[model samples]
Target: MGLVNKTRITDNLAVIIGNQHIDVIATEDFPFDVQIRFIKTDDAQLDDGSGKKVFTPEYQMAFAAAYKGKSAFFSNTEDIKSFTKQLKEIKELFEFATLNKQTWFDTASFDGVLSQKVGSL
Candidate 1:
């Protein structure tokens, strides 16, 4: 998996991590990309918490591992399990993005990724 440059949906921020296409659905008044914010959050928290309305640590680890130059390709059974769990965590986090009537991705970009057949197994 690589960061494949793709189309932008809403002129919003978009970043390609591994095989996943993440787009910014909303921004805080601060003017920084939330995907970057999330990557940074993993560094800051250093621990995954089990609770309502927050990303679990294992989720953070998946992205962190990937960001640290791990290939997006999962070759082992455990790797696949970890990847699936990471996606589940991301889907849950998107609910938070939705509360603001915003999304982590724009429709077109999402469609493009969806169209490309890149998906969680």
Candidate 2:
């Protein structure tokens, strides 16, 4: 969720994905428009009565790290592959919990992701 600052009047809205706050930087208002579109689709299912809904923070952070670290090159492919595999394991755990009607520890938080991935082992 990157938002380019348009005018001084527009309040920047963003998703706190992890340690970093992603903001869009563009020359014009088009950045805001693009962000809005992402919000519409991304936040669609995250609607509770209070309007706060669950989001996959773990997924977001993982992606953030992957992109920021740029771990897809030959030199970093192993790291990327390892991280992806960890996420896949978490996905499996999430699916199993859902299937069994078992409570899943929150996977939408940074701590939750770390705990499930690192603490479990």
Clash count for candidate 2 is 3
Tens-digit lDDT track of model 2 for 26-114? 22322112121011112224556787655533412111111333233445778668556644543443343334221212211223221
- Model 1: per-residue Cα lDDT at residue 67: 30
Clashing pairs in 1: 23-104, 25-103, 48-57
Candidate 2: residue 44 lDDT (0-100)? 28
Candidate 1, residues 1-121, lDDT tens digits: the string is: 4554442322332344323344443323212224422221222233346544333221111121123233467789997886566555445443433342213333212221111111121
RMSD of 1: 19.1
* C-alpha lDDT score of every prediction, in listed order: 0.34, 0.29
Q: Which ten residues in a row have the lowest lDDT in candidate 1?
A: 112-121
